[model samples]
Target chain A: MPSPARSALAHIAFSDLVVLLRGIFERHGTSAEVAAVLATNCASAQRDGAHSHGVFRMPGYVSTLASGWVDGRAVPVVEDVASGYVRVDARNGFAQPALAAARGLLLEKARSAGIAVLAIHNSHHFAALWPDVEPFAEEGLIALSVVNSMTCVVPHGARRPLFGTNPIAFAAPCAASAPIVFDMATSAMAHGDVQIAARAGETLPPGMGVDSQGLATQDPNAILNGGALLPFGGHKGSALSMMVELLAAALTGGNFSFEFDWDQHPGAKTPWTGQLIIVIDPRKSGGESFARRAQTLVAHMHEVGLSRMPGERRYREREHSALHGVAIAEQELAQLRAMTGD
Target chain B: MPSPARSALAHIAFSDLVVLLRGIFERHGTSAEVAAVLATNCASAQRDGAHSHGVFRMPGYVSTLASGWVDGRAVPVVEDVASGYVRVDARNGFAQPALAAARGLLLEKARSAGIAVLAIHNSHHFAALWPDVEPFAEEGLIALSVVNSMTCVVPHGARRPLFGTNPIAFAAPCAASAPIVFDMATSAMAHGDVQIAARAGETLPPGMGVDSQGLATQDPNAILNGGALLPFGGHKGSALSMMVELLAAALTGGNFSFEFDWDQHPGAKTPWTGQLIIVIDPRKSGGESFARRAQTLVAHMHEVGLSRMPGERRYREREHSALHGVAIAEQELAQLRAMTGD
Candidate 1:
């Protein structure tokens, strides 16, 4: 990608960015609270340098709201299906509020039951999964989450897309320092990352995906046009994707990747997906020393020239972005401004 | 790697194999019931053709017992840490009996609470993880298990072994067929498989592991000599290994991979590690329709030329072995008979 046109670049404080995003969603018809939740999440992504899931996603999201593909005024409902289980119905709306509502409940339930699961359905989760699990880890809980999205990846040995990127996130709190966290898509490359590469007119590295004929290719345009992404680590990654499909979609009564022909749609629609979250109270394991033990393991990673833990790079990026402000292209800012008449 | 000396072969009924294993363990010191639990698990692994974890592991196990590295008479104790949580202290014995004791309780707890976790410590887990989770899925529960072993895998980019193979297993129930399951090691190749390749005078494929100085190598001898196994899928698998270390060792109060160097030890001892089991009831998500939905997903996999689900191959192997009888090399039979004086 060429250098950003600096004359059209704008660096806004994190606080200001949040306000801008919140106002844009509000103008598009979401409740103030709902918009705030979505805005805060997106801004955090920007702060963490996850640009694909940050403000860059605004255009498609606003389009979904304006078209009523996602209900702007929806109030997610939660049902306590069992002592330690929660089922969240997002009511065909954005996933943020629904996930937020279950967050506290999950912590509470995990503490009492030792473990808990929250299943969310009929939601559009156009964000990173780390944000959802990271909070639990910060609160002294071990957390894991998986979400299925529009089909973009092919199962191992398959010629066509039959599974979503299906990212899985996990986090464990540490002593004093930030939590150790990882968020990864089951695909060799994430669908969002692929889209970014395609937009930048970049050719993908070899082996990330294949063309429609099932032949491996390095052309991003060919992939975005009619090709399918391959699973990471070949068969091992394929198995992980299969597990995510079962846990999030089949179990939650949400749309499976095969059920959605995302490419066939005339207009972009909300990603109707399911999410599965698991919360575990570390204290229940009789470990007040879990954090320290985890640090011992992490120290070994650092020694190996790995440089950073899974989410450590993101934390550093977030701090730098917070201090310097997040940069957005002037064109992107203008589009948001136009969408909201700001 | 050479063909087994079939002239020294024995065909044993699965039931007789279990009884013979039980008798040997009982003679060593464990009570009849404890031996039965362990023996049954070992036989089942053989029945499923998981030879590495089956009778092939018996020699080392017997050595551990003979050396008193593991307490053959130890009775595992379980405490209900919370409504849905259980902690099992294996008292320096094998993992099978400890897991068996908690199996029924896990199902009941999950039925009522929708999720349950069982943590076993001070145990030696040598059998495949599928047996632990497969029973839960058979009982109409979704199950996942992770166990950390003696460290043999280097975290991605690291030269030293600081993480175990750290296998994770998952199972989901279907309507009428056997449960769908997968058990995978985070390592690019299992240590046992590497040993087999070395014995066969075969070169390992690239990216499987590194030599002692951290240079990538295709020589299995270099890998098994002083080298460390690489995590599967590079960094993604490294992240998965880290998670297992946290969940099974850190959270369960067991030793981390770096904390133990069993490979360097001169004496054979049980892998004094921990196992974490999680069971979830899909019925809590509101319907008995889960099985049909899972079949729908499996159908998609089948159409893609991925003919079998993760566990289907093993299931078929188990069925064939059950009918044909398990084959044991005559020398292997002699070895077992010598150890047991039978």
Candidate 2:
């Protein structure tokens, strides 16, 4: 089964794509500020080839906004809680705007105190997590973030879904290369990827999920309908998911993955949870340049026969997009155009 | 093959075991302060039924000390790097004493700033990581720690071994339960567990490691001899191992797992690397007690049919040991007594 040729795809400049996405978001009920932040995030994901969180999510966003489940125009309230802590109440809005509102204070604290933490609650986080942390690495800092999604993953040794496909994202500066970055879903598979698979009528690998009866199944539809995904690496990943729930939800004073019920608001797709981000200034470390040391690690990784670093593929995709416009299937591009009412 | 009956094992009071182990450490040339910390740490592991890192590690500690690879009496030098960061130069000594020396200041900073980080360099870490973090949770703080060990793991997609069996341990408070705690190696299994299995002449599960020729094998001895372990969950765990190296070693001005060579000193068993610990004061959270939220999460997990939490078994073992005594094989107890010259 050969894929469509590159010539069959539509290509658009990154800026143009962002504009289009922004228009769609603004038209759908989000404030201009939120539309700007979300547009850039989704555009970046698309440019970097993270299609699971790219424009494919636009429909979900539109539907969620229409459902009145989320306050698309809500302004975030940021508090300087402590010398090293910043708290944000997203006012039932998206997490990105909350993070954007607190970014300056978080950066200030990290610079002055050597470390800082941002806790965003009452937020809907539906996009990729890496975008929240990678920028800090670009600023010569280390960042780690976690966000709990809607419950669809079963904890290890548990019979039902209690935990979300909670994801952990990390980024660190490197001297001679792009920042080291990785975003991993603690679940065996991301829910978005599962949806994609179901859409394409593809089967997943074994150990990924089980059916409603708790029998192992590889059918993406079954897993999406009533079954649940498993955590990666068994109990270790499950523990990490539990940690995410504590840090992102409990510590942030937000609803847990299973706490929010959107039954009345049909078409709601975003998880109304919380997020936590920790940033550290590597300049305050006792070591040689943190970035230089990271470069050394990269060199050693290559020497050991590693062909790519964790975020290398994304970087490559980004560069390709920069050189020759962002690639998208023609049909998907048409859908985006329809969404924009342009 | 059935395991030995509990009645066949010897039991000693926790304090008595600590005294015995302390004597062995001091007799092997450690300072009394170092001996006290190491003994309590080891004894706690034994009391918790974590035999892999319990009295079983005493021989390694003594041998490393005898080889003059690590200092036994060097005083740690702590630097108040920032309002939220503390750095410790361990002077080539054991990490526990360094941590003990700075724990108070770290706690104070975390309390003041809502979060703090402690970075210890030039330290030898050879014990279970859980003990390093569980105490922080006991005090109602959340703690996360990572330490990179000697290289024994092949990074995913790499041809050869480059990363250590880096481990991440986390602890958080729960309202009505013992603090939630878990320590896990990024590798398929902890190196200590592999050594214990090899000594017991037991085979490991598949995918644990490769033989000297890089062929998959279940023989634990092969992994201990010239082979290497694989990262758990493939690339995701490998990325975490890399993150541990960056955080624990690179960020602390300490040697990476593969950077230190102990060939000049025979009997060196500990990794001369660094350790990173991040502690957060959950009291600063905007939530209705963080511990209470964690308890709710635990309740939900149980409702989902979770049989036990991550560290429940360890807590149970500790309770049993408190009621009875710390169980140890008679042969091992005799060896410990012999090492103490008692």
Off by over 4 Å in 2: A1-7, B1-7
Model 2's DockQ score: 0.87
Per-residue lDDT over A25-75 for candidate 1, one digit per residue giving the tens place of the 0 to 100 score: 999889987899999999898778787787778887787777666787889
Task: lDDT for model 1, please.
Answer: 0.82
Q: Write candidate 2's Cα lDDT for B249-274 as tens digits.
A: 98988899999999998999999999
Listed in order, the DockQ scores are 0.71, 0.87
Which candidate number maximizes lDDT?
A: 2
**Candidate 2: pairs in clash:** none
Among all candidates shown, the one with the greatest TM-score: 2
